[model samples]
Target chain A: DAGVTQSPTHLIKTRGQQVTLRCSPISGHKSVSWYQQVLGQGPQFIFQYYEKEERGRGNFPDRFSARQFPNYSSELNVNALLLGDSALYLCASSLSTGEGYTFGSGTRLTVV
Target chain B: ELKVEQNPLFLSMQEGKNYTIYCNYSTTSDRLYWYRQDPGKSLESLFVLLSNGAVKQEGRLMASLDTKARLSTLHITAAVHDLSATYFCAVSWATSYGKLTFGQGTILTVHP
Candidate 1:
């Protein structure tokens, strides 16, 4: 079975620009979550969606937003990117919030 | 608000050595997860502990959770070069739909 898949393996953006990262969860999965991993640190939760509804959000600023589509795919959008926003954006999916999650090969975003 | 902290943020071990990494969280959680991530790669799920005293092992790694203490430990036995990577521990609340709070990863380097 295909695991979670993310688009644009790598990207470069200038400060103040906006970017969107996409993720397709594994087949049959209905829960998707987004995380941001800065260099030399662990991933921090951004948002989570279940059944195409916003289920939970982390402590991230309003500039970070996400949504899940009817198909269970997810999009993470970051606006007014700062150099600090350069990091690996990971997507994780699970059959449900009660189960273990599988992570996607994250999209590397470099905000210059 | 929840917070996770990992100790020995950096670890260097000789092949065949044994070591343990600790994860402590500031809030109650329903699940604890251990993940491994290679440089420039996404997370690889290792173990998920769902309850107090829950213990799960995979190959040379074992993870145990103590919910009362809000602590989890990942024990590495007979470490090898292939086991070298950054290990992270994350926790999620039952009502949050799997919104994870991750620890500062422990970078493990198993050398010969």
Candidate 2:
């Protein structure tokens, strides 16, 4: 079986630019979440979607948003990015709400 | 707010040494996860501890969780260079779906 997969393995953007990172959850998984991992720090929760509905959100600003599709795929969008937004954006999926997660290879975003 | 803390953020040890990394969370959570991430890469699931006193092992690494104490530990036995990576512990609250609060990660380096 295939694990969670993400696209655009690497991206480079400038301040005030917007970027989107995509994720395809493992088959039969209905929950998708997004996280940001800055260098030297742990991954921080950003948003979660389950059954195509928003389930939870983290302490991130409004500029960070995400959505889930009917097929259980997800996309994370960051608007008006700043240099500090440069980080690895990870997408994780689980079979259910309280199950263990499988993460994708993540997209490394560089904001200049 | 749920908070996860990890001890010995950076560990340097010789091969064949034994070490343990602790993860403590501030809230009650039934599901805990251990993940490994190499530099510039995404996370790899190592263990999923579902309840108190639960233990799971893969290769030379073992993970246990104590729900009553909201604590988990990842023990490395006879560490090898290939086992060197950043380990993170994550927890999910009962109400959240696919949302995980992660610790600051423990970076392990094994030398000969």
Candidate 3:
């Protein structure tokens, strides 16, 4: 079976621009979450969605947002990107809220 | 707020040596997870520790959880070059089981 898959493995954007990263969860998974991993640091939680509802959000600023689709796929959007926004965006999916998660290869975003 | 921390941000071990990575969290958690990430890659789930005194082993790696101490450990035995990677520990609280707060990661390098 396929694991979580993310689109556009790499992306480059300019400051003040916006970018949208997509994720397709594994089959039979109903929960999707987003995380940001800066170079030399561990991943940080961003947002989690279950049953297409926003279940939880992290300490990220309002510029970051995400939503899950009926199919359990998810999209992460970041507006007004800054140089600090250059990092790997990871998407994880699980069969339930507290179950083990499967992560995608992630989208490496670079903001200039 | 839940905070996770890992010591020895970097680990350099010789092949066939054994070592352990420690993860400490500040608040109560419903589950603990261990993940491995290769350079420029996403996370690979290694172990899921659900309860206090839970221990799981796969191949040369073992993970143990001590919820009473709010701590978890990942032990690696007979390390090999292929086992070199960054390891992360994440914790999810009962209130928001879908959101995982991760540690700072430990980068392990095994040399012959």
Best by lDDT: 3
Give residue A84's lDDT in candidate 2 (0 to 100). Answer: 97
Q: How high is the TM-score of chain A in each model? A: 0.98, 0.98, 0.98
Show the lowest summed lDDT stretch of 10 residues, model 1 chain A. Answer: A52-61
Each model's C-alpha lDDT?
0.93, 0.92, 0.94
Model 3 residue B100 lDDT?
A: 89
Q: How large is the C-alpha RMSD of every model relative to the true structure?
A: 1.2, 1.1, 0.9
Tens digits of per-residue lDDT, candidate 1, A1-112, equal 7889999899999999999999999999999999998898888888889999888888889999999999999999999999999999999999988789999999999999
**Residue ranges of candidate 2 with Cα displaced over 4 Å:** none
Q: Comparing candidate 1 with candidate 3, which one achieves the higher TM-score?
A: 3
Per-residue lDDT of candidate 2, residues B1-112 (tens digit): 6799999899998999999999999988878999999999999999988878999999899999988888899999999999999999988877775788899999999999
Ranking by DockQ: 3, 2, 1
- Best-to-worst order by lDDT is 3, 1, 2
Q: Candidate 1's residue-wise lDDT over B35-108, tens digit each?
A: 99999999999998998999999899999999999999999999999999999998888778668888999999
Per-residue CA lDDT of model 3 for A1-112, tens digit only, reads: 8899998999999999999999999999999999999999989889999999999998999999998888889999999999999999999999999899999999999999
Best by DockQ: 3
| Runs off by more than 4 Å, candidate 3 | none
True contacts kept of 2: 0.93
Which candidate achieves the best TM-score against the true structure?
3
TM-score of chain B of each: 0.97, 0.98, 0.98
